[model samples]
Target chain A: MSDILPPGSVIGILGGGQLGRMLSVAAARLGYLTHIYEPAANPPAGHVADRVTTASYEDADSLRAFAASVDVITYEFENVPTAALDLLEAAKPIRPNRRALAVSQDRIAEKDFLTGLGLTCAPYAAVSDMDSLQAAIAQVGTPAILKTTRLGYDGKGQARLRSADDAGAALADMNGAPAVLEGFISFTHEVSVIAARGLDGAVSCYDPGENVHKDGILHTTTLPANLSLAQRTDAVLLAARILNALDYVGVMGVELFVTPKGLIVNEIAPRVHNSGHWTQNGCAVDQFEQHIRAVAGWPLGDGSRHSDVVMENLIGDDILRVPQIATEKHAALHLYGKHEARPGRKMGHVNRVTPK
Target chain B: MSDILPPGSVIGILGGGQLGRMLSVAAARLGYLTHIYEPAANPPAGHVADRVTTASYEDADSLRAFAASVDVITYEFENVPTAALDLLEAAKPIRPNRRALAVSQDRIAEKDFLTGLGLTCAPYAAVSDMDSLQAAIAQVGTPAILKTTRLGYDGKGQARLRSADDAGAALADMNGAPAVLEGFISFTHEVSVIAARGLDGAVSCYDPGENVHKDGILHTTTLPANLSLAQRTDAVLLAARILNALDYVGVMGVELFVTPKGLIVNEIAPRVHNSGHWTQNGCAVDQFEQHIRAVAGWPLGDGSRHSDVVMENLIGDDILRVPQIATEKHAALHLYGKHEARPGRKMGHVNRVTPK
Candidate 1:
C-alpha cells in the first residue's frame, strides 16, 4: 500500500482543465477514482472525475481536506501556490516532486537547469527594470522576445521584439513582472518528446513529434517528425536528462527547436503536454495512462506506437468542425466538455491515425 | 438541439455496472456528462460518472428525478424493471427504445422476435406448470437446457437435462418460475455481432468475434472469427435485420451459434456486450462510443477495425495476474474497480492486440 496506489485508490488532481480531465479518465481506466480540485465553479474535468472540490488554492482548509482524502496528489498545471503546496505536502505525497515544479515555474531556472545539463538553449538573460531590459537587449541582440518567468502559458505574458528598436515596447508588455529576454534563432521546425520516468528509475520516451503553432498556441503535432537519427536521439536523451536531473516521477513534455546546428531546448512542461495528445491514438499506452501508471507505482509501458498519427487541437471555433471530422475515417475526437467557444481557448482535439 | 445531444449534455445511464462505467467515460470523451442510476451503494460506475443516484428502481420519484436531470436516457443492462422504465420513459427518451428492451427482457419475446425476422433459433417450448414442463421436454427432448423465461443471465436460473429421466429434476430447479426448454444444438463455435443503428436509420456492424465460455460465463472472444465470407456477411445482415425490425437506435449484441447449416440466433442484448470489448483496442470508434453516439442522435461510425484482438475476461482471481499482464506488450488491461474478487465475478478484461 505504501508503494502502489492500488485500484480504487483516490488520486487528487490539482487542476481541472483538459489535462486533468484526460488524466481522470485514464485513472478511471485503471480502476482508480479521481478527485479534482479547482477554483472554477464548472471545470471541464468535473464532468468525469469521481469528485470535484471547487475551492481556490489559497483556501488552506480546503487544500488540506483534499490532500487528506486522496492517496497522492499530482497536478495538471505547475503554478500551484507554494503555501498551498506546503500544507498539502505535509499531508500527502505530491508526484513529480517540488523540485520539478520549482524548476519549471521559473523560466530562468528551467534555462539554467537545461544549460547546466550541457544541453543547448537559446541565448537568454533575466530582466527586472528598464536598465536590465536595455542591457538584456544589448546582450541578446535584436529579434528577441521578453516573457514573464512565471504564469506564462499559450503565448500569454510574452512580447516579441522584431528588432532592438522594439525592446522598450516589449519590456512594457511585461508589466513590471520578472521577465526573461530570449534572442531568436533561425530554426527549420519545432518538435517535442513526451518522456516519462518511473519510481523504479525507468525512462520511456515517445518518438519526437513535429509541432506547428498558430497565433503562438499549439495548432497541431504530427508523429514521425522529420529528423535525422542523431537529432531524434539527442531530443530523447536531453528529455531523459532533464527528468533524471529532477528525479521526476511522471510524464513531462520537452519542447525543442530544430536548428541546422542542433536541437535547442525551448521549454519544458512538468505535466502532460498538448504535443503528446497524438499518443492517444498512436500508442497502446497513452501519455495520460503513462503518467497515472508512473504516479501509481505501476510498471511503465515501453513507448511504442502502433500507428502514425496527426493530432490537431480544436481551438475555439475549430470545434465547429467536429461534425465533419467525426464522419472521417480513422479520426478519434476528444472533447474537453467546454461549454463556450472562446477564441484561443482549447476546446478539444482530434487524433487522425494512419495505420502503418 | 432537437436532433443531436451536443457536448455538455448530460446522458443518464440506467445501470451502474462496468458497461455503464465505460459508457460514461466514452460520453465524457465526446464532451457529455453522465449520471448513473443504480440501487447499490458505491457502484463501479459511480467512480467515473458525473453523478450517481443510489436509489432503488422501484422508487418512482428517484427514477423521475434521474430522467429529468439528463437530456436523454439509456441503459447498460437489458433487465431494467419495466415499472422504473415507465417512469423514466415518460420524462425522457430511452435509446434503443422500449420495444428493444421489451423484446430482450423475456426469452419468449426474444425468440419470437428473432423467428419473426425469418431467423433460425434453437427448438424450444415455454412451460409454466408440471404438465407443460413434460410437454416441453417431449417436444425439445433430452440434452437440452430448461431456463427461466425472464431474468436469466450468465447461466443463472438454468438447469441442464442429460436424459428424459432428468426432466422432473430440471423442472424443479426452475422453482415455480416460468420456464423455456431449448434443445441444444451441436455447434462448431459461437460468435457475436456488435451492431449499431443510428437515429438516421443507418446501420453499422462490427466484425463477428468468436466466443468461448467457461462455467457458463464468457471466457474469451477472438476477433476475425473463422467465418467464411458468406457466413460473416450473413451474421452481420441478420443482426441488421434484427435492429431494423426493432427500430433500434443504439448498439446491440447479437449472439449466434455457428451450426453446420448456418448461423443460429442464440440471444440478443439491446446494449453493449462483453464480446465486443475487443473493439476498445481494435477499432477507431469502439462499441461504447458507438452506443453513445447512437443514443445521442449523432452519426454512426462505420464499424472498422485496424488490428486483430483477443479479449479475455478476468474472472475472480484472474485479476491477480494483472501485475504480470500490465508488463506484457500490446496487452491493454481494463478493470471494473470492484473491491472483492469474488469467484465467477467479472473483475476486468484484457485486450491483446495484434497489429497488422
Candidate 2:
C-alpha cells in the first residue's frame, strides 16, 4: 500500500477518452485534481482535468513531466505504451500494476492468466502464421474467432470463421499480426461484474449487469442481470480471485458468458467500464469514484445498488436524442464533451432508473 | 425564452464559489462548457471550469472579454454589482433575469415582492434612519429583526430585536445602512423547497427538506421532511408562484417557516442552495444540474427523490472527519477544494443515505 492521498493530491490519467473524462469528474468530487496526458488535442477528459499534456506516447520528455507533476498515476486504456509506463512508474505509483495491462493487452495472455487461476475461458490456441493458424483452427475446431492478440477493441482487428473452409479468409484478416484462435462459447447472455480492490486488498463487486450489443458495440447494460443465486456468488468470487491474483488496486470490469455448466471469462477492462455507468444513478458510490478511491488508498465505498437501472450508450447520431432524453423522467444523462460526433464514437450515455 | 444553448456552447457564470463549482460539473456532464468569472484567485469552480477570468467585477475589460467568450450568462450569487450586470446584459442573456437578482438582493424588496404575489411573508417595513427605524419597529412591533437591505449573507449584517427596549441596540448594530424590520414568525421547523422553472414556463420542485441550524448557520438538511401531503403541495405551489412572479428561468431555493396558520416565506436564493445538497444523492437531477438545464433553455427533468438523504455541511473543523466519512457506506462527500479551512468557512459537505 502507498501513502494515502489527501484531498489535494493529483491523480494522473493516461488516456483522455470518455472513461478518463468521467474519472476526472469523480476525482474532482473527491477533492483530488486530475492531470490528463493524451496524444490527441482537445480530448474529452482534458476539459474537466486540472491539467493536460498534449503529446504522443512516444514523447518520453512529456511523459516524464506528467509523471513528475502527479502524486499517483492510473491509465484509462489498456494499450498504453510500455516506455511511458516505465517513466510514470519511476516517479509515481501506478495502481493495478502493469501486469494486468500486460495480460489484457493480448488475448492469449488474458486467457492464459484467467485459466491459470482455475477460471474457465474459451478454449484457445496461439496462431503465428498461415500454417500455424490452420493447425490452431483444427485444434480449436470450427465456429471460432480469429482475433489479433494485441491492440484490438470493440470487435475490431478480428474476423469470424463459421467453418473449416473460412480459416484462410480469417487468417488473412489478421494481417500477419500475432493472433489467437478462440473456440466460440455458446452462452445464454453476456453479463459484467465491476469489481474494486482497495489498497488494503479488500474487494467489492457490484451486482452483475446483463449487456446487449449492436453492430458489435455495447448498446445497453440492464442491472439486476438474470442470474441464479449460485451464479451470482460464483461471479463475484471469481472476480475477487482474479484481483487478488494480480495484487490489483482499482476497479476492473469482468465480462462473463453465462453457460449451463458455469460462467466463462470473456475479458477484463483495467479501468472503469461502460457497463458500470449505471452505478452513477443506481448506487451511492459509482465505478469512477470506486476506481479513484482504490488508487488513492482510501477505503472502497459500498458497491451496492439501491435502484434498478438501464444504461444506454449514445453513439454518433445518438447525441441528437439529448433533447428528448432531457425530458425523460428519472433519466441521468452524461456526455463525453467530444466536439465532433464521429460515427461509432461514444458521445455519452443515459441511465434510466427502473422500479426495483 | 432565448435560443437554447447547444451542447458545446459556453455558459458564463458570475460568482466562482462552491455553488459555481458544482454547477460547472453539471454543465460539463451535459456537454456544455463553462467560463467562470470570479474576483478571487484560484477559485474552486476554476479548477473544473473550461476557462476562468480572475478579475474584479469593476474590471470592464475583463468582464467584456468574459461576456464575449460565452453564449449566455448566469450567476451563483445575488450580490453582483449592478454596473457589471448592465455591461453583461447588453452582450448576453442572463437567465433568472436581473429582476430576480434585484428582488433577492434587498431585504425590503424581497419581502415586498413576496407579499405582492399573495405569498405570506413576515410583515416588514423599510427603515432609512433612526426616526424611520423607531417608527417601523413601533409598527412591526417588538421581537422583530433588523437587517441590512443588501450585501448580507449567512446571517451577517443582522440583529434580533426581542423587545421595545432592544430596538435601539438592534438599530445601532445596523451602522446606519438602509435596513428593514421584519416581524418574527413562530414556526415549528424550517423547510426549503428547491424548485426549477424552465424556459417554457413549466415548473418542477423537489420534495422539501427540513433544515437544522446551529450558530445561525445551516447544519444539516434531511429529506422526507415532516409534512402532510397538503403542506407539501402547498409548498411546491408557492415556490412555483414565486418563480412565475419573478419570470424566472432557473432554480430557486425557497426557505419556508411552517406555522399553524400556513407556511411563511423566510427568504429565497435565486441559485443552488446549500440546504438542497441532498439532491446530489437523492435525485437524478440535482439543484445544480436543474439550474443549468433551466438557464440553458432545456426541458426540466424529474425532480423526484429516489432515496432519503441527510446532507451535513462540513464547515471548518467539520472537514477533519472526512477520513471516517469516506469509509462510511452510502456517504457522498463533496469538497469545495478550499486549501484553507478557517472557522465558519464551508470546507465541504457529506450526504448520507438513510432509510425512508
Candidate 3:
C-alpha cells in the first residue's frame, strides 16, 4: 500500500461550493491543511480552509502553483475540465483518478461505462445531429430525455420528447453540441448508496436512503429506504463492485432507480454527494471525512448507522425556516454561508435523527 | 430573547487553546467569524480562526480594540483574571456571566457555591495560613488535600496530605496563599456530564461518560458509562441544575465523583470541556457548536448520541499513533495542528465509535 499522507499535510481541493466548505472543515478536524482552488470571489469554502487560490480553472500558472503546494489533490465537483485534471495529474496525484471523472462527466459515457460493468441502465444512444436523433428515436421511442453529453447539472441542458412531434424541436435546440437520448424507466422509487473504497481496497457503505426530488433537485432523503434487507444488500454490493471496478479511491455516490424487479444505475458522483449529507448526523463517519480519509490513503471508517434519519434540503426561501427548525428536539441544522438564497439553490439542510 | 447575532458578526475568544480552536471552527460552520484574542504568539486557535489578536492581557489599548471589534466575548479557559474580564465586559457582553467565573475561579468559592446550592461535596474548610491550616485539619481530619484557592489546573498548586505528618510541610509549601483543605472521599469512579443552556433557558445534556485520568490529565472517556439508569439521570440533572443556577448561556462541563452513597460535584467548567470531544464524532451536535448557539442567543441543538464512543487523548508522542489508529474500521482521528509535540502536551485525540 502507498504511504498515507500524514496529518498536517496539505490537501488541494477544487471548487469552493458548500461541498468544498464541508470538506475543508472535515480536513481541518483531522489536522490536515486544505488549500482551496476556485475562481469565485468570497467562495463558501474559503471561509474555513487554511489557504485559498482564487483563480480561474483555465489559469495553468496558478493551477500549477496550487498543485505544487499540496501533497495530493481532490475535487468537490466532477464537471472539472479534463485539461485542468491533466495539469493537476502532472504535478501531483489526483484522487478518484481521471478515469472516474472521464466516465461520469458525460451522460453517454456514464451509461456506457455502467452497462460495460454488467450493470443495468436505461436504454440510451449518442446523438451528434438530427440524423442520429432520428435513429435514436426509432430505437428508443418517444417520452425519452435528450440531454447534452457534457456540462449539464441540476436539470439543465436537457429536454423531454413526449411524442414524434417533439423530437425535431428538441434536436434543433441542441445547437449542434453532442447529446444523448435516454429512454425513461418507470421506477417505483429513487435511492442512492454512498460508499467509500480505501487505497487498501476496503469498502464500506451507509444504508441506502430513499430520495425524493422536486424540479430535478434533491428534496429529501429518508434512511432505511423501502428496500428489503436483501435488496439493500444488493444495492450496497453493487456500489462496492463499481468502486472496485473503477479502482476508485474516496467516496462515491451511486444514484439508482429502484424498480419492481431490481435496481438500475442512474449516475455516479465521484465526490461526496448531497444525498449522503444525512450521514453527518446519523452515522459514525460522514461522507466528507470518509472521502478525505480515502484520498489521503487512510483506512475507511465504519459506515454503520445508529439512528433512522431524515434529511431535508433547504432550498432558497426554505432557509428562513432555520429558526423554527432549530427548536425541534431531534433536528440538527446546518446552513451554508451563502450571501443570497437564490431560487433552487441549496442553502442548507436539517437532519432529524430518530432512535432506531 | 435578545436579537441573534448575524453571520458576519465577530466573536472574541479570550484563550487560544484546543477548546478555542474547536469553538472557532464551530463558529465558522455557523457562518459567524471569530477573532481569537490570546496573549501567546502562534496559539493553536490561531491556525483556523478568521483573525487573531496577539497582545498581553494587561495591554488595555489592545484589549479595548479587540473588544470593540467583536460583537460579543466568550472565553475558552475559566482562569482569566477578573481585571481582564472587567475590561472586556465594559465594551461587549461576556456569556456565562462574571458571577459564574468568580465562583469557579477559586477552589474555596467553588466548594462553597456547590454546598450553598444544597449539593453534596467532600468535607472541606478554607485555610488562610498555618493557624487556619491547623484549625482546618482539626475539622476536616487527616488524609486530605490542600489546594491553592486560585490559579490551579491539571493537578498544579495542590498537595496531598496522605498522612497526619504531611500537613505541616503542605501548609509551608502553600506559601501563605488562601487555600482549601478537603477530606478525601472514596469514590467508585469519576464521570462528567457535558451540557449546554441557551438564552431561552433550553438545556441539553449528553450522556455522562466515565473518565480515566493519567498524570492529572484526562486520558480517556467511554460513553454509556458503567452507571445505573438512576445514576445517569441524576448526573444529567445535576448539570442542568448548575446551568440554571448560574444562568449559563453556553456549554458547561460538570465533573462528578461517583461515591457509594451517590454522586458528588467535583468542579464545573464554564465553557466547552475536553471530556465532550467525543461529540465531534459520536453525537449530532457537538459541544463546541452547542456553545456557539448558546452564546449567539440562537436556539440550542439536540445533544443526541448516534453511536457508543470512546475518545482517547493524543498527548505528546501519542500523536504518532494516528496512522495505526486511522487504520481502524471506525476510528475518527483528530489532531491539533501544533508544530511541536512536547511531553504532557495535548496534540490531538482519536474517537472510536461503535453502533449502540
Task: Name the top lDDT candidate.
Answer: 1
Angstrom error at residue B348, model 2: 1.4
lDDT for each residue of candidate 2 in A1-356, tens digit (9 for 90 to 100): 23579778899999999899999988988888999999999888877788889999999899889988999999899999888788889998998799989888889989999999999999899998888878887898879999999999999998999997888889889888999999998999999999999999999999999999998899999989999999999999999999999999999999999999999999998889999999999888999999999999988987788899999999999998888898899899999888888889899999998657
Sort every candidate by TM-score, greatest first.
1, 2, 3
TM-score of the A chain in model 3: 0.98
Instruction: Compose the digit string of candidate 2's lDDT tens values, residues B41-79.
Output: 988898788889999999999999999999999999989
True contacts kept of each: 0.63, 0.61, 0.51
lDDT ranking, high to low = 1, 2, 3
Better of 1 and 3 by TM-score: 1
**Where does model 1 exceed 4 Å of error?**
none
Q: Estimate, for each residue in B1-356, the C-alpha lDDT of model 3 and write its tens digit.
A: 35688766888899998899899888887767789989888777876776789998999999999999999999999998878899999999999789889988988888888888888888999998777888888899978999999988888888999776888889887887889999988899999999999988989899899999999999999997899999999998988888899988999999999988999998898889999999887776789999999999888877878778999999999987877786676677777878788988999998888777
Model 3 pairs in collision: none
For each candidate, the DockQ is: 0.66, 0.64, 0.54
Error of 1 at B348 (Å): 1.1
Q: Could you give the interface RMSD of candidate 3 in angstroms?
A: 2.0
Give the lowest summed-lDDT range of ten residues in model 1 chain A: A1-10
Ranking by DockQ: 1, 2, 3
Residue B90 error, candidate 2, Å: 0.6
